[model samples]
Target: MVKSAGYKMVGGNGVFFPILGFASIIAFIYLSFGDLLSVRYKNEINLSFVERNGTNFVVDGKLFYINGWNSYWFMDHAVHVDSRPRIRAMLQAAAKMGLTVCRSWAFNDGDYNALQITPGQFDENTFKALDYVIAEAREVGIRLLLSLVNNLDAYGGKTQYVKWAWTEGVGLSPSNDSFFYDPSIRIYFKNYVKTILTRKNTITGLQYRDDPTIFGWELINEPRCITDPSGDTLQDWIEELSAFIKTVDNKHLLTVGLEGFYGRKSPKRKTVNPEFWAADMGVDFIRNSAPSAIDFASVHIYPDQWFKRKSLKGKLKFVADWMHSHIEDAEQVLNKPVMFTEFGLSDLNKGFDPSQRDEFYKVVFDVIYESAKKKGGGGGSFAWQYLVEGMEEFNDDFGIVPWKRPEMYRIINQHTCRLAKIHGAYKPVTGNMNRICNGRW
Candidate 1:
C-alpha cells in the first residue's frame, strides 16, 4: 500500500504509463521469444557422404571450416549471456582473427528444465544475445555452431534431479519426465528456434544444412551421463527426433556432440563418461549406435599437460596420438566429418608457470597437425574460448581472452596452430563390406 501511495503522490500517468508499456513489451518477449529460444535452423536436411583423399573437411563441395571458441558475446552469464552491443565487439575480434565459427552454449540444466527455479519458466532476455549473435556473425563473415542445450546439469543429468528420476516405465520411452522422451522439451526448443529466426530477420535462413548463417547443429554439449543412465538408450527416439528436426528446419547440418569418449577415458580414472558405455569415442559408437540420426561428430581435448609439466605429461602426449588414430577409426566407421570443439589449458593465471603454457602450446599444435594432416577424422579444433573474462572474474580460470593472461594469446594465437593445416587439410575414408549387417540397412 505504501508503494502504491508513493506512486500516486506523483499523480502522473505520463511517467507510469511508459514504464508499464515497457514492462509489457519485455513480458511479451519473455513469453514468446526468450523463454523457449532455439537455433533458427530448419529441420529438414539432406546429407550426402563427403569424402576427401587427404585430411580435409569439405561439405557439399565446399571447403568450409572455422577457427573459434566457446563464449557469450556481450552478455554476462551471472545474469545475461547475450549482449548485441558486446557481440559487435566479438564480431570485430572474430573478423580480425579470421575465425569462421563459434560454439555458443545454451544450458538447459536442472533449474531451467524442470523450472525448479521457475517451473518451466525461462529467461526471456537471455535469447536476445543469440539473435544478435546470428546476425553479427553473418555480418562479420563468421558462421555459428550453436550448442542448443548445455552440458551443465540443467538439461536433466542422471542423479542431479533431487530424488526425481527421468527414466521410469519403459527405458527412455516417451514420457513427460524423461529428458529426451518429453514432448514439452521439444515444443519449448521449437519455440526457441522460431523466435530466433523470426524475430531477427526472415532472410537469415535455416542455419543447419540449408541455412546460410549456420554451419551445423550440435545436439548436446558433450552429452553424457553425469550420475545415472541416459534416459533414452533406444536411438530410435534420437533418429525420430532428427527426423523431426529435419522436417521443421531443412537448411542446416546436424551432429551429436559427444566429445572424445574413448580417447579421454583413462585406465587411470576408472570412471568413463557414461556415454562411453553408450557410445565410446571410437569406431563402435561413431559408426551407428549412438547417433545414426545425424551427420558428423565432434570431441574436445584438455590434457593435464599444463598441470603435470612432464614430457607429454607422462600420459597427456598419448592423447594426441590416441585421438589421431581414432579419427581414422571414426572415418572408416562413421563416414562423416569431425571437429575438435574444445581444447586448451584450464588455468587462466598469467603467472602460473611458463613451462606449462609452453607444453600446452605444443600439445595443441601437435594434435592439430597430426590429427588434421595424418589422421582420418581431421576436422579441426575450436579452442575452448576466445574471450571469457567472466570465468576469471570469479577466479574460475578457464578463459583465453578478457583476462588476456599471457598464456591465452600465447597458446592459441601465437601462430602455434596453423590455419591451413588445421582448416585446409583432408582425409580419406575406407569402407568395409558389411556396413549394413543382416538387412539392418
Candidate 2:
C-alpha cells in the first residue's frame, strides 16, 4: 500500500526546441512519419480492451507487459485548480519514462476533498477531479489500475466504513474488521462500486466502465481480515464483491489487492512469508485469487518495512526468493498472471543508502524481466509511489521523484524500453533513442 499526504502547486514548465541544422532536416522527416505511424499504431492497439490470455495480457493480438508506478494522490491533486498541474506533470513524466500503467486510489471516502461524501452521496466536483485524471492519462496513453478502497486507515478505509455503519446503528461489530462481515456495510460498498463504474467522465464524456484507459479495478488495497484467521471471512467477501463488480462491468479486469501472504491453507508456503504472523493475516493469495470473478493476482513487496533488521544484502536475497516463489505459483498452481503492484525500499531505514534502493529496484525488475522473457506468469510491477517537483509535502519514505533521482529514473526507463521491445511496441522518438534505452541522459 502507499502512504498518503497533501500537496499544493499551480504552474507548469515550458518545453523549448533548438534551431535545426542541415542534418536535422532528414531526421525531422523521418520522425514526422514515425509520429504519424505511432499514432495510428496506438489507435489500433487501443481499440481492444486489454484481456488476459492464459497468464499474459493481450492487446490487439499482442502480448502486453506492464511497466508502471503508483501515484495515489492524483485524485487529491486534481481536485483543486491550483494543484491540477501536478497531476499533468506526473502523468507526462510517466509517459516520457515509457511507463504504461499507473495504480492509484479511486475512492476517498468521508475525508477532505472526498469523492464519496456519504455511503451513496458523492461530490460532483471531486468526481470531476477523477475525470480529469482519467482524461489526462488517456491523453498520454497510460492505463490506470484504480483501487476501490484501502485496508489501512489512511484514506477513510475500512475504519471509515465501520464508522459509518456504527453511526447508522447497523454495524455488525465494533471491530473494524466487521467491514467484511456486515451486510449493511457490504451494500454500502457495492453501491459505491456501481457509482464509480457508471460514472460518466465529464471531461471525455465516457463512462469509466467503457473506458479502455482503465487497466482494471482492484477490489481493495492490501486487504487483511484479522478477525477470522481462517481466511474464510475475507474469502467470502472477495467472492461477493468481485462477483458484484463483474456483474456491473464485465468488460474490465478485476483483482484482489493482496500482499501475497500465505494463509492457514498453504502451510508449506508460509515459510516464505516475511514473518510467522503474516500467515494469520486472513488473506490466502491463491484462495483469494482463485475466484472466477478475479482476473489476476496482485502482490506488494516492502522488505525495508517488513524486515528492518536484515541488512540490505539479506533483503535483496529475500526479494529474489519471494518474487520467484509467487511467480512460480501464479504460473503453475493458479495459471494466472501475477503483478507486483507495489514494491520499494524506504530511505528512512537505519543505515540507509541510495545505492541500496537502486539495487533493490534492479532485483525486482530483473525478476519480472526474466519471467516475461520465458512467457511466465510474472506480468509486471508498479513501484510504490511517484511524485514530481514542488510536491515535497506529499512525499513519503517510498516516494520517487524522477528528476531529483536521475539514477532511479534511468533504471525505470531502461526497464520500460526492454519491456516495450519484448512486445515489439517500441516507437522511435526524434533523437537519443539509444541513450534513452541505455539509461544515459
Candidate 3:
C-alpha cells in the first residue's frame, strides 16, 4: 500500500496507518452528511384520542364535536396507486370546509384482491395504501374513525365470513346473518382485528394501535342480526368485540356502527316511526351501545329509503323526531355520546327535490347542534358520504361533491363552521382533571 495523507512512515506499519486515515475520513463524511440521504417527511403527529365527557367528546382537554363525513371509499380507492391523488384532494377539500373528522372503511375482506384476502391473510399493498390514507388525513389535521367490517355484502362483509365458514367445513349454515353468533365465523373476524391493531403502518412507521390520528375503531359497520330480532346475538357480539379491541388498543375509543334500530325491546320506540325500527337490520341502539367497553354510540339515518311514501315535510318531521328521541335516550338512558354516523337523502328517490335534500340536511345539523348544546344531544355527525368531481359513479344519489352541488356545499360548509365554532368555544367540565364528567361509569 502507498502512503496517503495523514499517514506517517511508521516502522512496518504503513498499511495500518493508511487504513486508519481512510476510516477517519469515512466517519467524518458520514457525520457531516448522514441526514442528506434520509428524507424526513414533516408529518403532523396527532396523539390525542377522543375521550368522552358526559355527552361530549374531549380531545386534548377540549370538547371535540365531530363535523365530519363518511368517506367509506378512501381505503377501497387508495389501494390502487393511481387513485391516491383523488383521496388527497377530498381530504384537503374537507379540511378546508372545517370538517374535523372522517369515518372511513379500514378493512375489506374475502376476495383475492381485498385488503384482508382471506381471514388471516392480508394484502400488503392494500394495507400500505391505508397507511398512506391515514398519514394524509393526519397531514391535513383531520382525525379518522376506522370501521373494521361492513354489514352489507358488497365489499366482502359478513356474507364473506359466512362463505369462509362454508369453505372450512364448519357445520353452521352458510347464512351471513349467522355471523353474529357463529363461533367459527367469529374466530376469523377476531384474527382480522388483531392484525389491524398490531400492524405497524409502513408509511408512518407507527403502530396502528398507537396512532392518535385515529379517533377510534368501529367494531363493525351497521351491524345487524336479522335472525335474532331481540338483539341478543348482536349485543353479545358487540360486547365481545368491543372488549377485545379495548384490550388491544386501550388508547382509542370504540363504537358499534349501528343504524339506530330500536329493536323489539321497545315496542313504543319501534312503533314511533316504523321505518326507524329497521326491523330487517335487527339491532337495538340502546342495548348495543350500553356495554362498558363501547365508549360511544353511533346511528345512521336514511329517510328516503325508510320513508319512501312520506312527503318531504313528513320525512323532515320524522327526522327531527328521530333525532330528538335518540338524543333523549342517549342523555337519560345511555348517557354515552351519540352521533349520526350516516344520514343523507337521495335525489333519485321519489319527490327528489334538491331543495328538500338541503332542507333535510339543515334539520339534521340543527338537531345535532341543539342536542350537543344540552347535556345529551347529538354530539357529531358524518353525512352519508362525500365524493369528488370525477367520482360521480360512486354517488348512488346520496353522495355530495362540494363543487357539483354548490348549494349543498354551502349548507355543509355553514354547519361545519357552526359546529367547529361550538367545539372550539365550549370548555370541558374535566379540564386538566382528565376525568370523564357526566359519562357513564
**Top model number, TM-score:** 2
Per-residue alpha-carbon lDDT of model 2 for 1-441, expressed as tens digits? 332221111111111112223243234324423342233222223445789998888887788888889998888777777667576667766766778789998988887778888899999998999998988777667789999997877667888899999999999887999999999999999999999999998878889999988999999988999879999999999999999999999999999999898998796455788877788888898899998999999998888777757788898998999999999889888888999998877777777788888999999999999988887899999998887666555566777786567898778888877876666653322223354465432
Q: How many clashing pairs per prediction, in order? A: 41, 0, 2
Error in Å for residue 96 of model 1 = 1.7
TM per model?
A: 0.62, 0.88, 0.84
Residue 184 of model 1, lDDT score? 46
The lDDT values for all models are 0.45, 0.80, 0.72
Candidates sorted by TM-score, best first: 2, 3, 1
Top lDDT prediction, candidate number: 2
Instruction: List ranges where model 3 is wrong by over 4 Å.
Output: 1-40, 44-47, 276-280, 423-441
- Report how far residue 210 has shifted in candidate 1, in Å: 5.9
Q: Which runs of model 1 end up more than 4 angstroms from their true locations?
A: 1-56, 59-62, 72-85, 107-124, 154-177, 181-210, 226-237, 263-292, 305-312, 348-354, 374-376, 388-391, 402-411, 414-417, 421-441
* lDDT comparing candidate 2 with the true structure: 0.80
- Per-residue accuracy of model 1 over 381-422 as CA lDDT, tens digit each: 676555522222312243455224555444454332254443
